[model samples]
Target: MFKIVKKWREQGTIERARGTGLENKKTTNNEDATLIQHLRAHPFTTATAAAQITNFPASRRTAQRRIRQISDFRCRVAAIKPFLTQQNKENRMGYAMQYLIFDQNFWENVIFTDEKVFQSSRNGKIRDFVLDSMKHILNKTIAVVDFPLMCGPGLVVGVPDCVGELMVD
Candidate 1:
């Protein structure tokens, strides 16, 4: 408070000087446009490669910063997904259509079950052990327990049993 008052009394204004830093010249409007064009043509190109083609050559770091300034684009790994063929799509559509015609009673006779397995390091008497030890054998186990069946209103009998399991390492 005292410092602020003192500054106001002497300068009559409370404003701090902006920090000093070298101005960016390598990424002018023209150079930035060219860099963007290069990136669009070859998205996987490295920053150093893109910088080399600009009118005013810049470092990889400078090229990256300029690209960030232009847009919110960022490099990332592509997500993996299963590829579905035309036959797969047609089969899925047919299955869905068959279910759509079924009434509430038909759905009540469907019991869906799923199981998941997990593996982790085990602890020993002396100290906790890691899986790196060759003697250790990771137990891959699955447990199945009865679960309450809840399907709409009244209790339905004779539901067909279906089981599915997913294992990950």
Candidate 2:
């Protein structure tokens, strides 16, 4: 309004006032660069540990804020995965290569089955009721005509002409 008009009349441009905060004096470019370098060296280091440096000594909160300002880095839990050795990789590759040579009919004949054992503890005795129940259910559903070929602990027997509707008990 009137103040704007008066200011505009006095000064050619209507820009806001500058240099009115402690944000600039908090940390310099050099300090930020040093902190970034330290973070790069030790990525898993906590803000509290990083703040203990002689050159860029600050509180944990301040250190975190500074780090955030530098990059889009955030803390996260590491995911667990199965450890595979060289032999494991080679074996996996060989298995895949063997399948590549075979036709689609080869896979149709293969009956893939997986079983998980659920352990339950009651009083002093460990009752494996879940595993027994699962096995019973599978046996009832799958009707074996000829001699069933057992692959592993949980069998993957190939039953010919018995791939109809499964009878669940």
Give the root-mean-square deviation of each candidate in angstroms.
Answer: 20.3, 21.3
Q: What's the lDDT for all of these models?
A: 0.49, 0.50
Candidate 2's C-alpha lDDT? 0.50
lDDT of 2 at 35: 73
- Write model 2 residue lDDT over 3-56, tens digit each, in one string: 778889999666666764534557777777777676555544455555676267
Backbone collision tally, model 2: 0
lDDT of 1 by residue, 60-140 (tens): 787778777774445433233356577865665565455557788876765445222222212111111112222322231
Residue ranges of candidate 2 with Cα displaced over 4 Å: 1-23, 80-169
* Winner by lDDT: 2
Question: What ranges in model 1 sit over 4 Å off?
Answer: 1-26, 79-169
